[model samples]
Target: MKIGVVTFPGTLDDRDAARAVRLAGGEAVSLWHADTNLHKVDAVVLPGGFSYGDYLRCGAIAAQAPVMESIIKAAKGGLPVLGICNGFQVLVESHLLPGGLIRNEHQHFICRDQKLIVESNTTAWTNQFSLNEEITIPLKNGEGGYIATDETLKRLEGEGLITFRYKEVNPNGSMNDIAGLRNERGNVVGLMPHPEHAVEPGFGPDTKIAMRSGVDGLKFFTSVINSLVNA
Candidate 1:
């Protein structure tokens, strides 16, 4: 399968995301923010970074980019989309997923290896995870807090749309420790962690087995490949 990784100006992790895709056994296609085409890719990934320098609001301006126009339509039609960190901000800003990401309650940027639990593994991005499995991935963001109206939160909870939850601590004060979410169709997912950073052995997070050997995040990409193959 071919997975397109979108790159907006100031995007920092597009190459990492593409590498993850390649490591997951898929062809990585580079998609630019200025282009309205998706290049016939099978899936899309919005990588992390401060697009438009996070001016006005994180992802607010980049959400209006030409590529997002195509992405929005494709996502609604069941194209698999994964948004990480700043990309999560863009997904919320694009209204592809519910709720919004605000600044961390502590008012500072944070970077760490964070624990997350797989809440629902039925989504395209998370199908490789076992239910309730705990995994650690890199979490770094300034405006990573997730918020939604009470009604929306209730709806998401009731509908089983919550995909991942913070396992031990809420790193950015996301409501109910929601680290990630999926759309009702389970095709689109947005999260505030950098899964791409954890796809390699020596570069991944430290784990009990070995230093920087936790490659749990590789499943996020492989899951999509499996999903597409099984589809």
Candidate 2:
């Protein structure tokens, strides 16, 4: 399978996301923000970082990029799309996903190994995980809090669209401890954690067995490949 990793002007984790795709047994393709073409990728990932230096609002400018125009159309047609951190903000700004992310309640940037529970495993990006399974991934963001209207929140909960939830603690004051979400079609997912950072055992969050040994995030890539293969 070929997965496309998009790189915005200020994206910092595109390479990491590409590496994760490769490590998960898929070909990684590069997609640029200015390009309308997706290069025929099976799925697409919008990795973390401050796009346009978070001007106006995080991911606000990047949401209007040419690449997103193509991605939004494809995503509606069932192409899988995963957005992380600032990319999550873009997904919301582009209206690809519901709700919005805002500055942390503490008014400071945060970086840490975050624990998340798989709330829904039916999405293309989360099929490899078991429901309610806990995994650790790196999270870094200044504006990561998630908010939504009551009706939207009820709909998400009723439809099982909440893909991941914060475990142990709510790190960013996101409502209902939402850490990630999938669209109604299950082809689009957005989260504030950097799953790309946890794909490599030696470089990811530490585990009880060994230092920096967690590789739970690799499942996100493999799950998408599996979804494509089965499709």
Candidate 3:
């Protein structure tokens, strides 16, 4: 499978995302923010970064990029899209996912290893994990708090759209400790964690496997590849 990792100007983790794809036995296709074409990739990963220098909002500016126009259309058609951190912000801005990301409740940037529970394993990006399974990944962001209207929140919970929830502690005060969420169709997902940073061995979170051989995040990429194969 080929996964396209989109790189917007000022994006910091495109390379990492691409590397994770490669490690997962998929071709990593480089996608520019200005390009509408996805190069026929099977899936897309909107890596975390400070696009447009976070000028207007974390991802507000980048959400209007030429590439996002194509992404929005594709995503609606069931194309698999995973947005991480700032990319999650972009997803919300583009209306691909519901809710909004606000500043941290404490009003300071946070960077740390976070524990997340796999709330739903039915999404394309999270099928590799079992429900309620806990995994640690890196979380770093300032405006990562997730919020939605009460109605929207209830709808998501009622529909099982909540994919991942913070475990142990809520890092940025996301509502219900939501670390990630999936769209209604389960094709698009947005999360405020750096899973790409935990794919390789000897460099992931301090979990048992990560402490021995870093590979906690590998399932994320592999899950998409497996999904595409079965599709």
Candidate 4:
């Protein structure tokens, strides 16, 4: 399967996302932010980055890109869309999902290994993990706080849209320690963690497998590929 990784100007992790797709036994397709065509890719990954230098707000400008329009349309039609970190910001900005990501309550950029719990295993991108399973991935961003109104929060929880929650200390003051969320259809997922960074050996988070053995993130990419192939 071909997984399209969108690259906006100033995007920092498009290459990483593409490499992750390749490692997962899927073809990686480069997608330009201004392009309207999806190149017939099976899925899309909006990698983390500082698009438009985060001038207005994280992902606010990039959300207007033509590529995002196509992604939003495709995602609504049940195409699998995974948003990582800043990409999550874009997802929220585009209203493809609910809520907004604000600056960290402490007002500083954060960079660290973050532990997250897989809550809803129904999403196409997260089906490889067991429910309540904990995995650590690189988490880095300035504006990473997730916020929604009380009613919206309740709706998300009530509907089982919350996909992953922070397992360790709350990193960015995200409501309910939400590190990730999925749409009602379970085809789209938006998360503030950088799963693409942990797909390879000697460059991933340490785990029980081995030092630098945290390939837990690889399952996310591979699971999506498996989902597509099976579908």
User: Model 3, 105-146: lDDT tens per residue?
Assistant: 999999999888999898889999888988888999999999
Candidate 4, poorest ten consecutive residues by summed lDDT:
207-216
lDDT of 4 by residue, 24-139 (tens): 99999999999999999999999999998998989999999999989999999999999999899999999988999999989999999888889998889988999998898999
Better candidate by lDDT, 3 or 4: 4
The deviation in Å at residue 91 for candidate 4 is 0.3
Write one digit per residue (lDDT tens) for candidate 2, span 67-155: 99999999999999999998899999999999999999888999999999999999999999998988899889999999999999999
lDDT of 2 at 1: 93
Give each model's whole-structure lDDT.
Answer: 0.94, 0.93, 0.91, 0.93
Give every collision pair in model 4: none
Q: What's every prediction's RMSD, in angstroms?
A: 1.3, 1.3, 1.2, 1.1
Error of 2 at 172 (Å): 0.9
- Minimum summed lDDT over a 10-residue window in model 1 is located at 205-214
TM-score of each: 0.98, 0.97, 0.97, 0.98
Alpha-carbon error at 33 in model 3, in Å? 1.0
- Candidate 4 has a TM-score of 0.98
